[model samples]
Target: MSKPFSQACENNKQPILDKLLVHFRQASRVLEIGSGTGQHAVFFAKNLPHLQWHCSDMPANHAGINQWLADYPSANLHAPVPFTIGQDSWPLELVVDKVDAVFSANTTHIMQRSEVPIMFDLIQKNLPEGGIFCQYGPFNVNGDYTSDSNRDFNQYLISQGCGGLWDIADLQVLVSGLDLLHQYALPANNKLLIWQKC
Candidate 1:
């Protein structure tokens, strides 16, 4: 592909940046997980001059991300680092420097349910106290889907090998070390959840 594209990323990048601009203003380094297509990394890095943006994904997605980076090369934007949550020393091996913020968009429900906590474990190990982690996706509240669309989406995804939508309550229990700081309701019934390491 000349340059991978994501309509979802195109639609939501600005809104995500609106929050991260203020939220991560002080953050010097940001590690983006599941950087599908590397679209968000390029957009965010270009807009947010203060942060050094690091894009990461599985080896399968490296070329797409690298293509994006090469096309819109930024001094603060780094290339992809092999990342598979739960693998031993994967983060340390790929990420050479310390990171204060972790960002991932629309990835939780697409990954295996059992893999979610492992992802959190890796973030917890790397993100220091007071570090921020922002996740953008559709999620549930009180064990209930927020809308019929989300319910149908969850069912459709579960029918495949992908995980279903997650609930805030369950996530709080799963990653108790991180304190819920703010929850922003985004368009299309999606959400942007910000957590700070405790």
Candidate 2:
């Protein structure tokens, strides 16, 4: 069976890539969490040849990611890594050197609130000092939805049993001691949370 494609992923890939190119121009290895459809991994690896791209997701998503990455010949793009939020450890056998950056898109709102902190902790463990962690998604600011569209989307997501939009203030509090830095907003209602390990 052919793998499914997400239109939103296609629509947002370029704009996201543009921002990434600016901030991650010097990064060498990027660990991408929740690499759904493998589209972003392939597109980014192709564009940022200097940086090694590591695509990771739950085991079920690996097949589709492998299919998308099969055609890419760059030595920089590593095979998909099986990763899950809250897991005590990763599947990779060797403790490879810490990554330079970690990136995730549209994943935070789908995971439970408690899982978010665990995810950040894992990112902190895997990233080296000064490593960058970038997350993109719709978020609430000061406990209020940024737009009616986001509010509606939050309801829809919660109705489906997934976690809804998160509050920026809440998230900032979670990362308070992690030495993270917030970057400017993205094109969509989504914001990019960028941080570096101090």
Candidate 3:
């Protein structure tokens, strides 16, 4: 089987890593919720050797993720972890022993609106006090789109029957248990939001 690839992942990995380095500088372990293609796993683990990067997703993506992990072979990077979303028990399954941070990119807007709250709930339950959750994706503020591209993207997502451009404020309301730390605007009109378990 050939390695799966995502051009967007390739483009965003470095910038994401730069932000992660600052926020998770002291973190020893991070659980990446949707490790699509394992590109971020390889790149981040190579760059931030101090933290253990655990890559996980639904079983279907495991093969591709494992292929990348096998090729990279970082002692600190663990990939091919299988997980189910919105199961309530799902996050606990992935949590296993210890996790200092949780990261998921480009997942929230693709999931159903109902599932977004569930994901937040699970992250809240799994992360210890003060643990950070880094979520990167396009988001709205007060029901307003930040860019024309994001507006179009939201429409496209709606056409596909998926939730799109979740409101950053709405997310804060959903995960009220978590404190919003930082919100960084990225190159592609996307945003990286950091929230800490309070």
- The numbered model that scores best in TM-score is 1
- Encode model 3's per-residue lDDT on 67-117: one tens digit a residue: 998888999998656766775365454557688799999999888888888
lDDT (Cα, tens digit) per residue for candidate 1, span 39-65: 999999999998899988888899999
Candidate 3, backbone clash total:
0
List the pairs of residues colliding in candidate 3. none
Task: For candidate 1, give the lDDT of residue 92.
Answer: 72
What's the lDDT for candidate 3? 0.86
Model 3 residue 22 distance off true place after TM-score fit, in angstroms: 1.0
- For model 3 the TM-score comes to 0.94
Number of the top candidate by lDDT? 1
Instruction: Estimate TM-scores for all models.
Output: 0.95, 0.92, 0.94
* Model 3 / residue 120 / CA error / Å: 0.8
Instruction: Report the C-alpha displacement of residue 98, candidate 2, in angstroms.
Output: 2.5
lDDT winner between candidates 2 and 3: 3
How many clashing residue pairs appear in each of the predictions shown? 0, 0, 0
Ranking by lDDT: 1, 3, 2
